[model samples]
Target: MGEAKELSQEEIEKIKEEIERLKKEIQYHDWRYYVLADPVISDAEYDKLVLRLRELEEKYPFLRTPDSPTQRVGGKIEGGFPTFPHSIPMLSLDNAFSEEELVEFEKRLKRFLGDENLEIEYSVEPKVDGVSIELIYEGGVLKRALTRGDGYVGEDVTPNVRTIKSIPLRLLGDDIPFLLEIRGEIFMRREDFEILNRELLKAGQKPFANPRNAAAGSLKQIDPSETAKRKLDAVFYASGLIKGVEIKNQKELLQKIFSWGFKVVPDWKIVKGIQEVIEHARYIYGRRKDYPFESDGVVVKVNDFRLREILGEKAKSPRWAIAYKFPAEEVTTRVLWVEFQVGRTGTVTPVAILEPVRISGVLVSRATLHNFDEIRRKDIRIGDWVWVKRSGDVIPEIVKSIPERREGFEIEIEEPRNCPSCGSELYKPQDEVALRCPNMSCPAQIIERIKHFVSRNAFDIEGLGEAIITQLVTKGIVKDISDIFFLRKIDLLKFWGIGDKLASKIIDNISKSKEIPLDKFIFALGIRHVGESVAKILAKRFRTLDEFLTANPKEIETIYGLGPAVAQSVEKFLRDEKNIASIKRMLQAGVKVLDYHEESEQRKKGALSGKTFVFTGTLKSMTREEAKKLVIENGGKVLDTITSHVNFLVVGDLGDRGTTSKLEKAKKLGIKLITEEEFLSMIKGS
Candidate 1:
């Protein structure tokens, strides 16, 4: 390697040719090592070729381009993520459920092309259930990794993406484009996901719902180091932004990416017609468990790129590609009866007691009706044969009821007007649809509240499961949350299931729960609209229980992120004589809520302080209370009413009336309108 200097024409040409040859050789080895997982050359041999290329690029600075293999040395740290516009709009695929639908899709493609006699080859592959990403390469090096944010614009997650070993740092081929954006799915392997979830559980963290959830959560982590630990894998499926070359068909595109050392989806095949496509889809669906990753269905596409162009695309999806989603794992059962159950927050939800049926390898004797409104909407009735499906093969839910098979004995359900457990009058809150048991002392509500109080994220009292809570409430050993602390070993030993060992364990857990943080104590109280995040904000704002109880509604309202409804709820709860008495009893029973006074003083210097925020509508990623807590945690303020002092008006799925008033007010005040995604990004960075 030599420094850049004026060189003879012959030397320059020779060096350029060598650089190209080295790039080609490195790319071939990369393909063999990465995509094929069969390295033709030894690791030392591969390193030599990369070293030579780097030397040539270093000596001839002008020869160094974005696509140069030398540029793949990716370790750049980003401060804040910026939005990157996709070179080509990343369109989603339409779905087909059955073989008949698949045939119809072929017909639609033929109809659009206006060539009935045309034979269209189909390329079918398993549709990976993971986070969609667009990885951009320049010259030969990886440049940017982006999320499929709304198709057009996406957040740059280059730093996190760089940590994935499966994703190549640079394109291997000598013909690497000036700019290429390869679209792929980033996922966690099933085994790795299980390991991660097990570790999370052991560490007292909530485990991920599924592999897809774990992958998405890992990818979106603000800390790249955390993502790096997840061992994510990716497979390229399509091209988003391409330059300097053209691909002829889906098969060709897949092969080209594979050749460039990009891992393409496995088990893909090019078939002659719709029948073959259907057969391939069936095979993949049946053998889905054999794969290392999770896939919901298989994707079928018109093989020829020319035909795809002629068929074109719809507003939301491509006409050429259709995802054949597997039928939901479902079973048929009869609803014995519908029971209304009260939650810790007093919301009464309807649960259906079903004739025992096996669904997705699990016995589902009970399913949630969600609420009375859903029961009515679905027209569910007692003794009716209903279709039940386990969502994500986890929670069993009634999908629909069969009217034709309904017997005359089937009964139409009447919504409960009173709490079933305590016969208390139930009331529907304003702007809410669900009927609630407002009485805090209701037996059902008391059981649920006590269960919630001891559950994880609150006091986290282990050994106090729903069964234990039921036993405690039924025997009158625990009439309220505070009663748990007062339970004696003799009293517990009297219960049918309680042995000496189990009783000691339960008593120990209850004793340990007494020394909880103020935030956890506040959350354990089960205040309406005050979730874990809101509890944290309240704990940070008020140093002691006395301060929190003494704070007026107006004073609470002034704190940033406290919405009008939440402020009112807090005030009303505090003013309740029974609620106050429960707190006093808990305190007297040796409950010690640790004050975070020092922590609150430290939080005053947080990045968000002094800035007022007003949020309108429902946030999808988090609750309004959670969003407000983030703002408060960062030292920002939350306002119930949008005013001129408000710096930002965070908007989500706004109601018509709420949107109109807030939008007009914000416009008048010249406040910035922030989308929920933007606000979330801001919080992550903060």
Candidate 2:
């Protein structure tokens, strides 16, 4: 090859201009896709742009910059993440769990300011459930990312943060600050977290208990590439240290951050007085699930930056802001018995059978101990009263045992030496905390697998409850999950109490379930670590069962949001002769795995999107529950309390409850009050 010719000054300057153009174009696309959740171009189009930019930067190495979009996943730090002192202390916020406490917080502010009847404007935002970090930007470029380690000092996580596409590598606009310290929360979306846990399980590794844990774990990863795979996101909420620009208030600061190509807290509002703050808190608490990420509470801060200056700081937290926490979804329940249950993977888990208690409307009777180690760590004992917390859709867990409430009757839980289902010797894996039976033929394992295959999120085969599954496994009629497809009505008739009608209905349901979605089919296979969410991702990527089966570990690993563990598990399952045979048998029995299609954008954006509604009093047309369901179905949210954010307040028949507090509050806030008929009409029209 001929020697490469050196470019002239004009050529270099043109190249520089081209590079800047590409960087700006890529940054705009990134902002649109990541920050706005609205992309102007397709993934392939975006990739080409990035590829072109990379090629140009590669040929012109002298023009390469740290703020380039291609520099997202940097080389891993050799030693470990370094620690750095923050420009200003990243103080924690005091918490208030009730309206009264919030009022008290406001009263304290008033008392300190010596203004008795002082009207204060407060900025309210969701307290995002994630790890807190401070980002230092020097001359519009990101300088450092640090975790909130002790307020004054934090561990540098700049490399890991760069991997987050939502977080900008450099500030946009010409009026950028010379030095700016932005504080924000790094969180994983619920959907991403579900997919991640599925991959972790597939790799035979322990899954994160929640999204918050997953975000924290992903942020601290040594490898930037690993962090990039996590699809972590962030939202900048507050500014710590700013040198060039001056912000008047919290709302203005948030807007400034948004203008600088960063996502601020969603649906943040400015309200007058403490009551409005309490109302916002109630609204947030009621519709927390509507958000993509977990939010534990609402952060209420004095809107005026000058007022914040007057309030100053406390020892560990800011006096201007207080976190209005949602009510704990926890209930004290006595553990009746500690039952050892064997999973489909033959892993023995300790489950605490609790005295029946209601938590967030669900009647909880049992909570997972996770493993023997968790039981020991929590010191959970049979007959001991424990605090069972049920957050969102996550399974209720024993937060901690109430040692003070425990009586002499409480018995310390002992690790079982034998599998609960099969009398096999139980052994704990060297690297895992779980004890396994190592028996694939264990009856409990078989029953559990069959149950999982027919679960609501899987094949959804109706009339096949746990009792029937247990009976099928015990009688040796159904040896495996695939056997259920070939079950004859005669075989079901042989079992006692199985009537002709029930058996026929079950067989009909099983037949109807043959034509299932690919994602459901994948989940029904009872593959370890492949949950419904992961199955959907796999289905979308592979499109067909044949494609998935033909895929090797390398091909599978190349897919975004998937790691080696998930790829290996999928490849291993497909390679297994028995599994393949079972799959073939199922196919031969007329199981058709249909291709997956994503929900249309129009359908995803419901008619009542971004609208908040509150229902009060009694309705003659429908129950409150029915009304709330309609709102949710139409992509609207329902809150228990009336706030400024509420678009409509649904009013029912007053009866003896005329001019209720909710109505008065709604009137005070100027929220639209709609009659029951109007509400019905609105939903019907939508």
Candidate 3:
């Protein structure tokens, strides 16, 4: 190779200037293609600019900078994502399913402000159904990106986020804020999601359930290059924490973000009053199907930042904002057949196989009939046209049967008398609509139980997916859930698709799952009526697996939140000799269930200690599970029922509906009723 000549100081400075210019040019082209959807140059031309930038940077490594467009997709992240606290919490919005609820939302805002007839301007934007994320910028340069883990904290996914071309590597304008936290959603367009799923299926990988899921999974990829291949997009809609900028209203804020080279939601409007807000919501809903991305609803917020501040926030959501949810999309499809599937709990669910139809951009081929009773109630028949409805991310369901369109050849779908998989006779429990297979050792039930046992919230064995579990069960290598722990790498390697490396990884994951918390172990058992919350309650009350195993139905029933049904189910499962034997075998196989209350002494004396809470209505800021988790984390208890011992009733938005039975009973019992905001305040203070 020829010796390279060293450049002079002036030449080096010129090269530095050229590198900066190329970065800016590439950024502009990226913005045009991704954000504006209007590229001035061709793809080859854009590639040439990027190529020249890469060559120059490669020749002179000193000229490279972190914010350079070429540095978008960096190396893989090690370990896992680190958690970071949001400067300001990203609260969820309360939902309004109807126009009346939307009007009521404005009424509530007025009521909170003590101004019944006040004229309030509202900003309406499409509520994109995607993963929420926060992008931090310091000194007008992209610093980090975080996923919305909870309202107060998030997971750092900066590497994956940087791969998104739509997001600017650095702020474009000179008037950028010194520090800005832009809040937005990371989403995949319907076309991109379909393409990605197709590619995944081609590669023998599982396809994503929805666009939102695709976006979320892509954002969490360990490698940024993998995330880049997913073609993810983002749109900035709000600001979290900002300095050195004066934004007076939502409209101005969005404009400012756009000027900084961030994509904002294309359709948004500022309306004068609640009526105009309702109109705008209706307009958005009407055009929802025409949008490129998935949007479940329209978010209505107080236009003025001052008004929003004055209105303040509740525990999990803002008081000044509400989401007007569009109605579930309904489509007509013929039921080709009805198939019965057995679940972990042995409940036989009737699934209607329908002629393939597309709803909300997803190809739907099957819809749940819920149960045999529902099938009879709805008079659903095979070979009959039915009205199927699909909401955002929810499973498609048969809304009703169209008897008028049904010909005389249509056959009435009847409940199966025998289990489809094991051919065991099915029986119905008292007051229950579902038919249960009494046989515990049924192959279908065993497969489902093992699947549940290895699920994410249970044992969380990473490689034991459905396909692998099925092969294990069908081959008789795994007869029960306990057999999983005893699995040998040599045995796993004998499987068709299993190689040495995969077998080792699976064995490692299985071994790692042997020691789990008491709550997870209880939930993993696939108990009929016991869920994660119930398991936690049981684990906390019993402290250890041995104590829980010995507890009787009466003792379980006496535990605060658990009712007779749950108690009876637990007692029935534990009292069974076969189940006890399985438990013993699992223990012998080296499973160790940890103690429930393993917190420090200081944590045991948390602020809400000894206090019991019952929640009613829909909470806007967080899900019911999240609220319960918070309560447990803060040394409080959450009960499903309203009882005399309940200390407080945390009431959320009741919408247009009247008071619930729990709310009414809480009122009758004189239980202190606190708002969601108050409940959040208690936890924050703790």
Candidate 4:
């Protein structure tokens, strides 16, 4: 390769000017926040400075890139993946359950290294609940993306990986070195997760169980388009291969990754030894879920990479790393009483009210008691000091009461005789934990139903929380669900803190919600056993609200997933006089009953419609999955290698050479290019 041409003196001067400005701006803020612990600027203000540099990059388009602070959100998620062979295997880390186990790991480390002089310096970080992935960069260009499959061999998911905007397309800015293998955890944001699950419900799909599962399930989508729609991100934690870099320690590597525009974990402090590490561990445990993402535990790794290399591998995992889980933050609190809440599934859940106590950096005044079985098994009683725990930022659960500690004060446990909400007799269903509230018209049920109607999954009415809902009912600003649609902002403003701007936003959201899809409308009705998925299935099957309402229960039950019980619920819900009147009120108020059946039907059809593909080399124009979807929709197949039966081979060079063999064979056998333009065309072809 010939020497690349240098810019003119004027160009160089301008680049120098921009670089100086960026450096001063970054360091000034770093000191103010990191050192001083007093940030004058908000996150959005900091983002503005970075965004300016990015905008400059777009303008100049070819400045000598520096490994400056701003490149972390990655370029554009590249189109296709290229092959990358690991120079060093990115291995897993070992776990330490007890203090004794940690001491054993330390002792084992000394034995492995056979060096008594080793005073191990470690880097501790929160172990986020997410999927692990690898990003490969060669000579500043993003080469490939990989999953930590089996440690040695992994699934080639370049296409799917390309959707993550955080993984750079070509290395952003000055770039780090010739070869860099960045390992990271991919996770979804909490707000994004809530949004996605809401959408999932409206689309008639099962909601993801949790954030970690959501991230895992999202990254594995064969359709890049599907994955792309999900807002997912990656956080770089460790390195696999470093070329031309002399960062001697793990802490430096983390800072370097941050400087190079990788979203490394937050800063860590070094301790003299394990004792300090233990204190730091406790401090982190105290504040674990306070962070944006969920963390199962904290990972303690040997700081020095050279020292780590000396310690080497033990079995499958690196000997240098040990994870310390937060001690379960269980609390002893009093459960004033147990109450049952009926969910969309008709499963009534019992919740416990408690004397407020701070646990795990959160106020714990309530806990889920589970049910009669849990209460009996734990021997929980009123006025008892019951143990409560909140893990990974979720709802708190009661573990047990101190039976032996009971003075004559703790009263006998008694399950409520009747539905607290409806005043009907409460009965425990066969093989069930919850006590049921069969009367749907109960005041509590109506209140909960109203809240659900305005929930993010249903109408998505903003500025309407449970507190506001209660106030609305009391003030008579709203009654039936349809009342929300009929009301005006002037009506809402009568509430105590309701301001002009917020009131406008709420009323606007209400107006906007009138255009909601059919599934949301159905969910807003609060029919028993009718969640987002069932609503969508019904919406698509019936194609119209009128068609669905009039359809016989037998026809409703014909849908594969809809059984007799669900069908009966649907019919019963539609037959209710209140429900019938509510629908009329909604339609009269101009609420849209949309037809999303065509789209939902398309999704149900397997979406691969069943086509397969295999790709090689880097795809510069688009991601592997994006291109794959095109081939799949065109009724073509993609294979991993250039076998005789291979229908097509996407032959493109990223920065790898190993894929040449497959391409050469494809040329001889005339396998096709999952062409960029044609691939895009094919995706929409269906």
Candidate 5:
């Protein structure tokens, strides 16, 4: 070990100057190689500068400081992960799923800047599909590495992050900030991920699901050695909690960080104007397959720090930056089988069970065929290779079958003649495409009904998932949705995975679910054609289940918006003895379905009351589910399509010049076309 010897003034000054000069040279080379993707010097030349700095620091120990380039090596390993509060929150970016959405993002930025014709410069970079982490460097020395746990608070994994070669151990120059927290993504390259997975498989371990998952798992490992073995890399994207840094824009920040011996994200371009932003995003999106690592989208940020500050952020994401995601990745996989799923409404949907394939970072084993008609239309068959798409990055859908790839032995998918659950005759209604199971007491129907009851849009039971619902039904713990509330702790504990804590939580959720609003409860009943909107309408009209159950079809038909199909479905559900018995059981279980009729009155007079909204295209601020919920919660009605009754059309970014029937109808009906932002404003005002 080098001694902490007292050095002569001349010797100390010479060593310090040499160290600073070497640090600057090395940093400049790093910037050239890593950031600009251009290097003037060879690898040996760069190493020599670092070696010289090390030699000088060794000869004159007093000349060394934390800010020296040599100090970039990781600090002492800790026994346990400690919590670290982020000096600045690592907020997520708002997403733009389509070109129109990206355009809308630019429009919003200009609007926020109070200039319709403002020439806004943007920095566009790949939105890496990886784990987000923050690196804190004090006096240029690596201080801590933190996982973005909740944005505000993070788990310290300094020991593990030290293993990443791309992240610098210390700042490059003495001119660097006293304290700098860099936000970056820790990712595994595609080739590296594949190699690691293969090694894991050879070692008789389960292969990683995807590169992102692999990166996350590697970073969280308790053993630093394990993380090192995984060969994780990082790219610094933005600055957080920086002291003594006067960076003015994203471009400057990128260059500055790169000059500090830190790796900057690749393919990032500084573009002028909104059109360039969109063009760059689209170009990057199209070249996704060519990249070395996984990237789902392109992130576009305002180049100016002032613009970013002015634009500010939302509760969850930054308003200044938008992630323009590519259309969900489509890959070909074989259909192993086609199964019929009996819904709570007894509508049998055709689900294509596929050979497990990875699609857009997800393990997709099943895709929806919608119905038997769709299967026929697409000519999907067992043993046929089909193009399975992760639609919108959420749903797995069979886009089309590769009929050319189909073998002669491929079997055509046959429509089920009888219900798969109860073996009852399946019937298809004249107006509908789905085959229905008439037996209300069918096991599949019961299971599905229970699932529907606990779904997000219905009772919203926190702990009662579909798998748990199936287990409860199969184990005879629950026979109907009402049985969920009446389950004993002992009964739930009998299930394999239902531990004491989980069982207690399930009980609590069931107890909480009893106080659900009238509309949600009505929708939870598994009644055909009685979706959330119809349920809301019925709840508003009748006020209570007792009132609704007593009303005849003709009486229900008198209500505005209550069509013949919906009225018939409601009347039929109420008249059924089995359904009535189930309702009675639910009542006996102490279910207190809250009345929303009075609230409906208050809502009608409220801000958005009397307003009917129709949503078109893709919304950026929220999901379609969230949007519908917002409308309903704000005392407004949501319609599927634009019509004369639709007071406002909440239009989203419908990419390109595609014609929308809803837009046409809205214009024809003189309905106001409002943007998603405008709709959000209306909701907030209400």
Candidate 6:
């Protein structure tokens, strides 16, 4: 060991002051970057200062610690927020992204409250940027804190919450209330957040976007001390589990909370009229920077908690309160051009390329315009200045256009008179917004049709996507849909990435797809107005694809959702000379596209005999197309989503959101969930 050199007291104190200043400075930069989405210094410059602190800490082993800037982002949260179902569902707040929207929300509330002569006010609290928690107090002692999982059940996080300083160790009042659950956010202080992110950047890791995400990632920690080191603070702003409580209104509740030694958000108001409410909301919006913790937006609730019960809630959100979410980001961008893109099924959709601009936090260079009709309706034009916005920091959209600044030379574009891809005639039927090319021989249409035919909803071929399809098309390897069946292993690797195994799987899949049941064959053909439901009906109504093809416009027009226009389109499509030739070539190509009903009828007349089944959730057991196949093969029918017509509803691990509704409706209408075990046991060979 080396002899220690004694320093003057002033020098020692100065060194200590420098260490504190550096930490504080790093913390402020973190807030500026993560919380505000605005950084003052270059990333390279930020790293140098952080490196100095870390080096000093290393030399002064006593100063070396996990709580310091080094170990924040080392771990990840465990699988899924475990369910600890709250007595009340943690309903999401309705967003108001702008001040105008906030005013409108206030207007409607005041108007409604006026009817009852009970003017309502709200407690404008800090909408903390962290994971929500339900802190349970047993006899004025901190007993438990659970995460808000799915509005009911949440993961047990008692150990993590114990580390936060703001969370009270003991209850304030000795009035001896029974078990009480106070809900609030758990977040890292601004300073701690900066150090964490700075260390992350130095390690060549992607820094977190905000303190909210950091706080959330930290508190859900599997290790308690790690969460404690995050310097997480809590504000018990709301109530969840409560016993022996007498609460009249929100204001009194907040005041009682503050008096009982709790940290209440400052400057809460009970503004009644719409104007005052709007003004108050604006005040908060402007003062968001002044607050210590991160707040994405403000929450406004009807002050009279009684009126809250009266207002009730919608199926999705509450009626009494709404959150006013300020615009995440917005910018003016020039529209470079709008082009039509045709999907595999010949749906002509519009895509817009914008002059590069930043919207929200991401770069905005392109956006989907949806359809030609939507473009015309929005009056979007090239060379026009348009306002684009992003919600929740992603997905750019052209919100509005500035027509006043438009030049007189603005050209009015008409939907293409012909198919851009095939150079054939395009047709738009009556009452339909989309214009489609009826040409089956069109190369673009052929690839799209063939791709959809092999999609998860249709033939269930997995290996063939754009890369392979492009290679096949470009190499003159596959021209029409039927050409795919003839592809050899060597032909697949003619491009890059494909091997003998992949080529064989694709070919095997192609061969398997040929033996498709009648319903799949019908849908794979991409007929007009024939969605899965309509196709199922058509499949049952007409036993074969050829028979349906043979039916005239007058006979086909009678089908549900298929009118005279669709009937004409279908009839016209079948009669096309080129399409007829393609059908002949497909038949000769040895595609087993003809209905299997003929073979089934030859054996047992009622292929779909006595069983009815419904499918729910995403299936890992089989593709939805394959499940439908199982139903058809065993003399059964498949229904869309869930309906009364379905006899057995097949359920999977799609989580408990919309599944319960389907189950409830099924119970009301008398449908049941079929287990794979029970199904296999009951069906035997089926």
lDDT tens string, model 6, 425-503?
7777664567877766667766777777677677777679977886787677877766776777778867777766667
Question: What TM-score would you give candidate 5 relative to the actual structure?
Answer: 0.66
Candidate 2, residues 23-126, lDDT tens digits: the string is 99999999999999999999999999999999988887778999999999999765556799987888767667568878878887898899989999999999
Best-fitting candidate, scored by lDDT:
3
* Model 1: residues with Cα > 4 Å off, grouped in runs: 1-33, 39-80, 331-347, 351-367, 371-396, 399-424, 427-686
Between the candidate structures 1 and 2, which one is better when assessed by lDDT? Answer: 2
Candidate 2, poorest ten consecutive residues by summed lDDT: 1-10
State the displacement of the C-alpha of residue 332, model 4, in Å, after optimal TM-score superposition. Answer: 3.0
lDDT of 6: 0.65
- TM-score (all chains, Cα) for each model: 0.52, 0.53, 0.84, 0.51, 0.66, 0.46
Order of models, best TM-score first: 3, 5, 2, 1, 4, 6
**Model 3: how far is 471 from its true place, Å?**
3.6
Tens-digit lDDT string for candidate 3 (367-388) = 9887876787788899999988
Name the regions of candidate 2 deviating beyond 4 angstroms: 1-5, 331-387, 390-686
RMSD of model 5 against the true structure: 8.4
Tell me how candidate 1 scores on lDDT: 0.79
Each prediction's Cα lDDT score?
0.79, 0.82, 0.86, 0.68, 0.79, 0.65
Local accuracy of candidate 5 as per-residue lDDT tens digits, 266-295: 789999987898788778877777876788
**lDDT (tens digit, per residue) of candidate 4 on 497-561:** 77787688788888988877876787678776565556665776888778877878888777644
Per-residue lDDT of candidate 1, residues 527-635 (tens digit) = 8878765677688899788899897889777766565667888989999988898899989989998886545754677666667777886554345765676677777
Q: What's the CA error at residue 163 for candidate 4, in Å?
A: 30
Please count the clashing residue pairs in each candidate, in the order shown. 15, 1, 1, 17, 3, 12
Tell me the spans in candidate 3 whose CA falls farther than 4 Å from its real position.
Answer: 1-5, 42-45, 75-89, 150-156, 194-209, 220-223, 244-248, 460-463, 487-515, 585-592, 598-686
